[model samples]
Structure formats: C-alpha cells, structure tokens
Target: MNTPVSALMPVGWGILLGLLAQSASAGFIDNSSATLTARNFYLDRDYKGESPYPAAREWAQGFILKASSGFTEGTVGFGLDATGLLGLKLDSSPDRTATQLLSYNPVTREARDEYSELGITFKAKVSKSKLSIGTQFPSLPVITASPARLLPQSFRGAYLISDEWDGVTIHVGRMDRVNLRDSTDYGPIGLASPNGRFRPGATSERFDFYGGEYRPATNLTLRLLRAELDDIYTQDFLGVLHLAPMGEGTFKSDIRVFNSREDGRAKAGSIDNLNVGGMFSYRWGAHSLGVGHMRQFGDSAFPYIAGGEPAVLSDGTMSADFVNPGERTWAVRYDYDFAGVGIPGLTGMMRYLHGDSIDLPALGGRDLKESSKDFELAYVIQSGPAKDLVFRVREAFYRNQQDAGSTFRSDNETRINIDYTLKIW
Candidate 1:
C-alpha cells in the first residue's frame, strides 16, 4: 500500500506553511515557473518466431503539466512541486495490445483508453542540500526512471541531494513504490532478470540507495553508488566520464561497472552478476564516431528495477539490452549534426550491435547470439512560431538465435514521436 493520507498530513501542513511564507516574501512567486508539455507517440512491432501473433501497433497522446515554486526565504527554505499527467490511447486493439503505450486490464486482457495520475513533492532546502518527500523522478547512476514512452515512469519515495562541496555531489533516497510508464497503480519493486523479466517471483517494499559524484577536474568525473532492494539483492555501481583534446576534435569516454548479488533472505534466489563496459567517441565538426563493448559475468544477468531504464553498460536500442548470461556485446555507431552543414536543429544517427557467447541454461546450457541495427532522425523548430516543437523517427531490426525464448522476439520495430512544450511563468 502507498503511504496513507494520515502519514502525509505533516507534509501537507509543511506545504501550507511554505505557501504562507511565500506570500510574506516576493521571491517565491517571482521565481516560480510552470510548463505544459504535449507528446504524440506511435509504435509498431512485427514479431518473427514460433506462434508469431499479429503485429502490435499503438498510438497515444499525452499531456504533462509541471509547476514549481521557489523556496521561502530563510536559513531553511521550503517549496512545493507538482506534476499532472494524462495519457489517451488513440489507436489500439485486443490483438495489437502489447505495445506498452497504454495500460492493460489483467482480468479482461483489454487495453485501457485513458489513464491519469498526479504527483506532489514537499521540498526543504538548507545550504546546498535539499530534501524532498513524495513522488520524484531521480536520474542517478544506480536508480533511474524511464521516459521513452508517452508518459514517463515515476517513483514514490523520499530523496536527499547535497552539493555542499564545490566539486562533489551526494545523493541518498528510499523508494517504496513505482508507477510504471503505462500503469496507473503503485506497485512494489521487483527485479528484472534474465530468467524472469516481468514475473520475478520476488518483490520488495523498500529500495534504498546512496551515491556520490566527484569532479576532480574540468573534464573528468567519477561516480560511486550502492543500492539495496530489501531482501532481494544489493548492487554497486561505478562510473567515469572523461574528455580530452585530440587533434582538431575531442575524444570522450564513458565507463560503467556494476556488481550485484543476492541480499539477506535471497528473495530472488542467489543472484550474482557482474557487468562492465565503456563507450569511447571522437567528435570533429559535424561528425562523430563511437564504439562500445560490454560483458556480463556469472549465472544471473544484470539486475535492474522492473519497467524502468535498463541498468546495463551499453547504450540501449529499441529491441535489445544485449545483456544475457555470459554474453559479450559490441556496438559501433555514427552521428551527424546538420547544424555543421548550416541546417540547425537537425540530427541523424545509426548504430549496430552484436552479442555473442550467450549462455542460456534453460535451453540445456545452449550458446546463442543476437544482433540489431538501429537508425534515428530528429529535428526541432529553431526560430519559427512553432519553436521548441520536436519530431523524431526511429527504426530498428533485430535478430536472435533464441528468439522464441527472449523477452522480445526477433522483429522489426518503428517509433515516431512529436513533442511540444509551452512555458508559463
């Protein structure tokens, strides 16, 4: 169950007091900001494998209204933040219902046409540190949300962030429930592992995490984090980002490492995994080239929060995480910026990834492989009356030897997105 209203009354009272204080001071109202965002999304996927059903296609429109008030003036400042989300299914049917763009009814096996949710946060600030209770969207290395669909996923919990040191940042949080991108209910956290992506047979009511980021230099950053899923698992993450000058261009590298194992009680049953990878890139003028390699070790695959962004090392594509037990993946990608050719607000990218040496114990310990290719084009209105309007198209092709056993079968997937944001001060 979610935190009850009785438990949240103190937070509500704090918000009311903050509002009174804001009226006493002009800074709160003067510095406040609000925005309304509209998003249109379309998805189509064609499956290929045994018992291949018809294609799954869906269309959706969403609206997000976000508002934030400035903190009241004092040694300890207080503020409030709110978000409203509404999603409408434009096109969907029972046969084409697994698109993840709309909520599904478990009993009727029907997709809902509409869903809505509201989130509120009461925040307090002391010096450079801030604390917030209620719904939050945290994009940390170890715990991150997903925004790839019509409405972004969100976590309901408490978060603390501190930047008291010049080049150091600290984060600590506890999440008790999650609202999936398409679902309208709060649910317990679960691990998304290879054996069970959706029904892991394990759930946790508490997820605690702490981390710090250090920037020792202008172009160098280091991060370390630890997370625990009550009795399910414990995970540690380390990441580094560095940039250097190379000839007329710039070279950059992003590295991430993860170590996970079953926690006390072992609700997920003896989970042990190690994941490491890095992406290196060079950018010159309008052209950029990058390559990445990732590896998974141990019997279990890398674990991450269900229905959220993947926590693997490699950059994600439309159809694959490239993360299987004993699997190694390599990816090559190229990007171009039209601005360098005098066409601002336009960009294009292409990527190809191959995964091999996958060990699937369920299939008699068979070794298999997979590969995928993806392409994307995006543009935004730069200076016209419809400025800030953005449009994007993405297409992907994936093939796997174990297509029938994978979470998503070998297929071709396409997505189209349109977004516009209006700022209301």
Candidate 2:
C-alpha cells in the first residue's frame, strides 16, 4: 500500500517550528513563495573509441513549489519550510534514452515518469547559535546538496550552526540518509576503503561532521573541516580564499587541500590532494570578462558529494574545483547584461575550456587532451502582462585529441528553454 501524505503531516508541522526559530531574528514572516519552471533539453554524444550508449535526444518538464514562514513570537522562535517537485516526459524512447531526470529500473527495465520528496526542518535559537533537526538541504565543503536536476537532493538528519565569534562561523551536523537526484527513496552513502577493497555491510546510519570558517581580514577567509563517513573514511580539509580588486572588477584566488584515510576495518590506504585555482574578472558597463586556471594533485580525485565520487580531472560544476589527476585546465568566459544596453532583463554568456595532460591509466596510461565550448543567451520579461517569463538558448561543442589511426569522433548539442514563473503566495 502507498503511504498517504497525511501520515507525514505531523512530522512536517514539527519541523516548521524549528525552522522558524532560526529565522526569527531577521523578523517578518516570508509569507509564502512558489515558482513553476519547465525545461526542454536535447543532448547528444559521439564517442570515437567507445560505445557506451547511442546518440540520444529527450524533452522533459518540471515544476517546483516552495513555501516558508517566519517563527512565532518568543525567544525560541519556530517555523516551517516545504518543497514539491514534478517532472514529465515530453519525448523519449529506449534507443534514445537520456538520464537527465529519468532512470531505467534495473529489475523491470522501464522508465519512471516522476520523482518527488518533501523536506521539513525544525529550528531553535539561543544567542547567536541555532539548532535544527529533520530533513534539510545543506551545502557545505564536505556535504553539499545537488540541485542541478528536477528536485534538489536532500539529506535526513540534524544540524547546528553558530556565529558567535567575531569573524568566525562554526557548523556541526550528522546526516543519515540521502535522496539521490534520480530517485525518491533515501539510501545510505557507501565509502570505499583505501586498500582497493570493498567493505561490505559496513553502512553508516549517520555521518558526523564539524567545520569552521574565520575571516581575519575583509578580503580573506580560512576554513577547516573534518568529517567521518562512519566505517568508510575519515577526512580533513583546509582551504583559503582571497579576493582583491583589480582595476574595475576583482581577482579571486582559492587554495584547498584535503587528506583522507580509511577508518575502522578499511584503514589500509590513504589519499592526499591539493588544489590551486584563481579567477580574474573585469566588468565594464554591462560586459564582464573572466579567465581562470585550476590544477589538481595526488592519485585520488577531489571529493564533493558524500557517496557519489567525482572523476579525476572532471569539472563537475562551473566552480572549477573538479580538475583532477595530473591535469591542467584554462577557461575564458564572457557575460553581458542586455539591461545595461537598454534591454533590461537580458543577458548572455560564452565560455571555452581547454584541458591537457590528462593521465588515463585505463587507456594505456597515455596523456590525453580535451576541449569544450559553451554559449548561452537568455531574456526575461521584466514587466507588463508577461512579467517574470524567461526564454533561454544554449549550445555546446566538445572535442578530444586523438592519435593517428584513432577512430574517435566529436560531440555537439543544442538546447532551447522557455519558462514562466508565477507567484502564488
């Protein structure tokens, strides 16, 4: 029998009170907010040497509803937050399958139509510290949430945050379950041991973590973090971020280092990594130009999500921190605001990324190179009958260098999206 939504109402109400306490000091209830978005995506890939899957195309639509409120009057304030998501298929087939929002069930080998989840958090505050429990989406150095898909990924657990120190903020938490991007069910995040062996049946009911950030100056910040993926691995991270004005815009630099070692019965190996990257941006009128470089060290790839490991030298997000394993990447990007050009609510972006010195041991340990370029243009109706409506177009081209007699091919893709957001508070 399917669980009824009513069964979850009691837990939802409890979480509302906790969240309100955290937002109480700010004053004023948020009232309520909701936004509906739809996307049409088309993706294609042609691999020269491998046949992972055939070229594919797909169209999908999604909707998101978010509601939040302020806490009740008192030293210990209380509030609630909730989100609803839906995704529908516009076009797809077995031969042209895309995993954008739908995944094939392993048992039945059928595509699922939709995925959804509900999250609520309860919060209480004292002085400058706040405590929360229940389901929440947290984005930290060690435990970042994924919102790139239909619904934002969430975790089931509790957390606490404090900002009492002059220039320091501290966070501590424990997470038990995670809802993946393609599935509504929550599962435990598994960790691999250092010795290249799998620790079977070693599951963590919850993972514990603690971290702090301190800013000694106006343009500099230092961070330290520690997390224990119960029975999997214990890791520590240190990072420094600095920002300085250069001409009209700013120059930002980031340096991060991580040390990971096996814990419990998996303490046979270890990973040490260091990442260094910097970006320089200049804005004149409505146009902005940016250039960045990032490099990685150590044998293992940089860690991001709790259980989902990233590929070495893979640029996971636009953050530029995903560069992995004996790799060096450089990117140049430009953004223009049409509003400054008298066309308000219009903007465009273009970027090119080139990577070299990729060490792929599986491909006979040969050094490889790859490059990709992406372009995006978007416009939003600012006012009038169609206010808040948006339209966007994007395209990308990817190419990989190949040796003589190699049978590799390049890939290209184009996508157009139009969305209208209606506020129903």
The top-ranked prediction according to TM-score is: 1
Error of 1 at 90 (Å): 0.5
Tell me the TM-score of each prediction against the true structure.
0.95, 0.79
| Clash totals for all candidate models | 0, 12
Top lDDT prediction, candidate number? 1
Compose the digit string of candidate 2's lDDT tens values, residues 93-149: 676564455554655545567656666666556677877666667776667666655
For candidate 1, what is the lDDT? 0.84
- Assess candidate 1 and give its TM-score to the true structure: 0.95
Worst 10 residues of 1 by lDDT: 1-10
**Model 2 misses residue 174 by how many Å?**
1.6
C-alpha lDDT values of all predictions: 0.84, 0.62
Clashing pairs in 1: none
